[model samples]
Target: MSFIQSLKSSLKASLGSKQRQVSAVPQIAAKASENPDLEKLLVIPVSDDPKEEQQRSHAFNKGQFLARQERWEDLSKIVNDEDQNRRASGGGMPIAELLCQGARADVVALAEHLLIDGTPEEARPLSEAISALEQILGEHSNNHVIATIVAMAHLDIAWAWRGTDAVRDTPARNLEAFELHCTRACQVLDPFCGIELDSPLVTSARCALLVGTPNAQTRVADDYEDLIDLAPEQQRHIRALGHHMLPQWFGSYETLELEARRTAARTQDIWGAGAYTWTYFDAVLVDPYCARYIDIPFFLEGIRDILERSEDQHNANLFASFAAVSIPNAAHLCADDLESCSALEQIQTAAQWIMSDYLHELHPLIWGHAMEGFDNHARIASIDALFKQGREKANQVFVRIFGEQMRKGNALIFTPQGLYVQQA
Candidate 1:
């Protein structure tokens, strides 16, 4: 049987009486079978009409191109126009692309105006954009794009407060607007599955509580606990190194404690699964820092451990994002001078070393995306240069770990089942 058919059979056996009722699996499998990248998996549904979807897709593509080109003003105009049309038609396209580029102040301003003044249909795109921008900013704390977006969020919030009489009449309206922005920020910055104590959202809620809102107090507590437990110790350690390396650069003790509590609450043990079947993944993104300090030995050891545990050989693929830096030097530098080399260069060198050492074993699974210091690398390098200075960089490295069973035609969605293997 095909992978999907096999998966369906397995799922049916696992679910027993409830198997007949589940319908999403087939649709998911079909989507994955058609597109190898799982692009549909990240899409947020906007409308059912084919024409609207096409227009929105075109607009999104244009917006992305404009962003890459640094043509912020033109990008803003196109998105605003598409958003307006979407409002008039009562349907729209996904706003992810627009939000991804809306880190510009003018873009955010235009989007905000459309959201507040346009039809009810505009609400969804606005909210999605707000949420996405907030999330991106939170994750890359020191990114200029993030700072710009946060500034815009604040500006829009201020404008809302000033433009309305709700501050005096219906305080809840103003509070809701502010809360949405903060919540988006929190969601973005918190680890994909971990609790976050330093989230601006949590902090804002606390402030609001001191000023009144008894219900928010309970929500704040619940959110805190949920964020903490999203990931356990090993995942946190592995992921944390991606943020910063030096112990001194890490967040304070209280922050770490809160995170630990939240993490403990969210973690689930999957060790009971006998031998995990292998599945291939399309990509594995890695932060430069992770490639630098943790990935090498950790990955090697992991491979060895998996082999020893399973006894039978299983193969999986890997993808990594890194910079290619060429330095002209003989082995004549002192230890302190070597340490002073650009962190980006060090990360690149380490990645090269790791790739070289594991080339024979990992060649099939390993593919590299070079960042000529223009894309994410530049932003991360800039962050490291400005704030931490060899401490930590404000950039994320995406890593996709494939299962041995995953095939080119197999559908892979970011659902609970896929996430289990992805996280592993």
Candidate 2:
């Protein structure tokens, strides 16, 4: 069988009794060419140096080969050993990525082994590997990439542990690990303020107070409650700022007006007023699939509002993670000389220009995320495929916007830290 076919078989075997059918890999591959947005979303960055690229390619392929052969022990050893070398070398790919790749591969091997051996003890090493990865990630409090990868690894390990005797016995340990991963993620990103700061003075004062306040425990509860009480309009505004405005700090009078109207209309719904509070997370490491919407003006605007509302009232630093997705060709929108085209094209052009400006302004933070490998092309493609179900049209528009941005090599401004526009 081909590599993709083997992968599908492995996934099916692992998810046995779960009702999900394997997605058609050929169909997914075909979609990229048929849709420009899809193509843009799938672009993975290649190393500039041919030698390094070849090595990475070879390593990944070799890892996959070991997985197919069901050499679980050997695969684990290879990845674990490589991880140690990677740390020592300080190579291009972050430690988190290396760990994740290794862990994911190891998990696949373990799953295959379990299918035959059915030994719970065999899974223990996988858990240990994941824990080791998390411990390393936790040590670096400021490294968002490591934190995110660790969090994801923890989640994966937790999922893998589920339904087993191990999980039933040590639920608290799993929960604690998961919580620690999230806590670390929050700490890594807290300085970036995943929400907009009305002004630098306000932001600075808030940060200072947070640092100085000796008894801030009582304030978290009140702040949480305040966030819960915000009107839908206020929440919507927060969401807008969280999603768009903060990512690029490009909100104009028109953008603000449109968001305000949308928020008002949505708030009129009895259930909509505070729904964003429950739905949005404080610190999310966005997947590639979710990253496509990062450049959409309306989407970013909504995210902004949500993030602002979620932050601690006294300090915007107590914020969520709005990490970017990595997909092929997923970048901020840019303008092109398509003025002679139809009216729709002209409108798209305008939107692209607006998005481009926003992304440019937030380049520092956004590029940082990309450099850390938080968002990329493959992840974006996966997200595009996943979200094409209920919100097909909206996601398609996002795909287009992202594709345009990628063509220009413009990094997305998808984090709150990207929103603070310094005055010249």
Error in Å for residue 204 of model 1: 13
Local distance difference test scores for all models: 0.31, 0.34
lDDT of 2 by residue, 296-354 (tens): 34433443443344321111111111222211222221112122122223223433333
lDDT of 2: 0.34
TM-score of candidate 1 versus the correct structure, residues matched by position: 0.25
Task: Kindly give the stretch of ten consecutive residues in candidate 2 with the minimal lDDT sum.
Answer: 312-321
Q: RMSD of each candidate?
A: 21.7, 17.6
Error of 2 at 325 (Å): 9.9
Give me the runs in candidate 1 sitting further than 4 Å from their true place.
1-152, 155-296, 299-424
